[model samples]
Target: MPIDIETFDESSSDELNTLTNAEMVVRFLATNDDKAYTPSEIAERIDIKKNSIGTVLSRLEDRNLVRHKGDYWAIGERETVRDAYRTHRIMEALDERYGEEDLEEWREHAAEGE
Candidate 1:
């Protein structure tokens, strides 16, 4: 038996290369928001490692960015997701125009709370 090989055009390859695992998972779930899937299903469809999916899903759940019930996962509220995307785009634009923020500098200036 022989295995099948997959191929991508230039644009698709570039797009895939630029997206992080979290982004890919979010995009996949968003596109199929009408349906829920197990982590294995999402990993297979997104071509990500099964082990990594759990961590990603857990983090997203903690942030209320995604929902999980039983063994299935689905995207969170549409408005929340949209707001997150909008904020991410704004950050990207700011980074491009003024350079990425220095984490240490930000931490130094951050207000302390009781």
Candidate 2:
């Protein structure tokens, strides 16, 4: 099988470079922290694909960046979310200053047990 490479126009590329699904979901829930909403509601509010919302929510929950109960989700603890967001910004700044870290290179050097 062969893969095709499609060129993206400026407008489309700009959209593609925007926030990741996790970032968008976190920001949306943070902004409306007082309320918990179903995945469908969050998807509609944030303009993300509904089908992908569950995966995003699950990952955030694993990081303790978001909470889930019944069929609804909400931002996690104030301090935890704040700390996570701060760390994220710091990493972005470091990546911009120094080219992004190569995961493959790190993996190659990682200790056997790790």
Models 1 onward score TM values of 0.80, 0.79
State which candidate has the highest TM-score: 1
Residue-level lDDT of model 2, residues 25-60, one tens digit each, is 887788788999999999988788999999999999
Candidate 2 regions with alpha-carbon error over 4 angstroms: 1-17, 111-114
Cand. 2 TM to true fold: 0.79
Q: lDDT score of model 2?
A: 0.82
List pairs with backbone clashes in candidate 2: none
Q: Model 1: per-residue lDDT, tens digit, 1-114?
A: 111232233225444568788877888788788999999999999888998999999998887789999999999999999899889878977987999999987777774431
Give the Cα error of residue 107 in candidate 1, in Å. Answer: 3.4
Q: How close is candidate 1 to the true structure, as a TM-score?
A: 0.80
